[model samples]
Target: MNVFQSLVSSWQFWAVLSALAAALTAVFAKLGVKGVPPDVATFVRTIVILVFVSSLLFVSGQFSIVRSLSRRSVGFLVLSGLATGASWICYFRALDLGKAGQVASIDKMSVVLVAIIAFLFLNERLSMLATLGVLLISAGAILVAVAD
Candidate 1:
């Protein structure tokens, strides 16, 4: 299979890619927020993301699906967008005020919260091993946050 097809077929590949991108995001955002207000930085970043993603949607013909989306779907998507904007604003502020490593470690704790929320609200089930893994991740994040 082609490299594109191989990547599309592998969840591990996407996860690793996302991790690398997130690492770069922290580093780049730390630099970008220097001397700039976090809110402004977030706004600029959001504009860039909107342009890039809109371009992707147009190029991939996904824009056609927008007209068919239900109002509920659009509302949920708007809510998600607002949440993402809030997250970026807070993340930029944290990076501006603290070391990126510490801030990112604390941010990683969201994974633990997401798992718990999914289990409770979405009726998602976690096996014993998965629960242990989440606990370990939480501990590691805490250790990183508290470390000198």
Candidate 2:
């Protein structure tokens, strides 16, 4: 099977797992900034992820995943990691400066950005309903941010 079919067929096995992972990420971040500075808390978070992932690699005998990455791939991985770190920093800073509802609402606007980027750069097409949905998401995000 192609990767997409493989994923769809196995999705019932992974859906809850993915949802739980998302929940843990949100909860941990909400709790993380409670006492710690957002930047340092973000650092602690990266360290925790590294520890957990490295342990999983060791325990699962998947060291080949770590070892097989080529130097160019390693550079791309590092760049992606840095970008994620920067996003986390900005996300927490937004939450630290504003309400969680507002920050999350604004963050969800990334969906619209991704859709537009895909359309522009990849020549992807959106249906009329999809275009309307993007506009609605953007409008809702603006209201969420501006609402008192």
Candidate 3:
């Protein structure tokens, strides 16, 4: 098999693993938020991620991926990681402070933000249905946020 085919074949494996990871994160955030401040919970969660990634490097024998990193790659990775950490902190804090359905619905509207940013900056085109869907998502987020 060629390289592309080999990579494509393993997508399902990665998807399942990612789903499980997301579920566990939600569970831990909910449970951990009961007593700890959101910032502290986020700090602990980030520390856990650092340890998990370190373990994966050793287990997968891909620890050398870090060695070949260029200056730009390292900068981007650190920025992306920090952005995700902030997003998760806000996400868990929102969930802790509000109804799950409301929080989730609002968060789901980030797709619209992605589309808007792409359209403006990347000059991407959106179909009619996609435009309508974005409107619907905004309305839904408003309703969900104010519902409870």
Q: Highest TM-score, which number?
A: 1
TM-score of each: 0.94, 0.74, 0.73
Where model 3 places Cα greater than 4 Å from the true spot, the runs are 1-24
TM-score of 2: 0.74
Which has the better lDDT: candidate 1, or candidate 3? 1
Error of 2 at 109 (Å): 1.5
Which should have the higher lDDT, number 2 or number 3?
2
Candidate 2: 10-residue stretch with minimal lDDT: 19-28
Whichever of 1 and 2 has more TM-score, that candidate is: 1
Each prediction's RMSD over C-alphas, in Å, is: 1.4, 4.0, 3.7
Per-residue C-alpha lDDT of model 1 across residues 1-148, encoded as one tens digit per residue: 9999998899999899999999999999999999999999999999999899999999999999989999999999999998898899999999999988899999989899999999999999999999999999999998998898
**Candidate 2 C-alpha error for residue 131, in Å:** 2.2
All candidates' lDDT scores?
Answer: 0.94, 0.83, 0.81
At residue 39, what lDDT does model 1 achieve? 98
* Model 3 TM-score on a 0 to 1 scale: 0.73
Query: If both were scored by TM-score, which would come out higher, candidate 1 or candidate 3?
Result: 1
lDDT of 2 at 8: 72
Q: How many angstroms is residue 89 displaced in model 2 relative to the true structure, after the best TM-score fit?
A: 0.8
